[model samples]
Target: MSTGGKVQWINPHMMRAQNFTIRFVKPSRHMPGIVALREIRKYQKSTVTLIQKFPFQRLVKEIAQNLKEEFRFQSSAVDAL
Candidate 1:
């Protein structure tokens, strides 16, 4: 899926001007990390809009436990995200 716009540079050094797209790879049962990464990337893209309309603390409380158990994410890591 594409974000469908020019990349906004939060920091000049963080990204290039080249076009970017996210493509799905074939799923593998054994790679939970890859699955988590994909899900996080999807969330990262929408985070700005999501946070504006939703209560972030509520959302985090709802999903934090699941993220920790399913992906083996530490509390600090989930908080950082």
Candidate 2:
């Protein structure tokens, strides 16, 4: 979920499908498309845990390089603010 609010478990089973029921919850916000697709391919794995274990090395390097290059080119003291 988005972590912006809470979900209520009012009606557990909404309707039945081929072999499953369309259960329901609250907060009324739809999940992102990428999240849904990743879940489908995870083989019943927990996306939350996977995201928690994700490495930030690439992201950190990109950010550090950007800062270094910016200062090397045309940086001012105001950039630190």
Clash count list over all predictions: 0, 0
Segments of candidate 2 deviating more than 4 angstroms: 1-55, 69-81
Error of 2 at 14 (Å): 21
* Residue-by-residue lDDT tens digits, candidate 2, 1-81: 464666554433444424565544657655679768876878566535433212444444466687786423223322222
lDDT of each: 0.55, 0.50
Question: Can you write out model 1's per-residue Cα lDDT over 11-42, one digit (the tens) per residue?
Answer: 43333444444433443244558878998999
lDDT of 2 at 40: 83
**Best TM-score among the predictions, by candidate number:** 1
What's the true lDDT of residue 67 in model 1? 62
Alpha carbon lDDT at 22, candidate 1: 42
What TM-score number comes out for model 1? 0.25
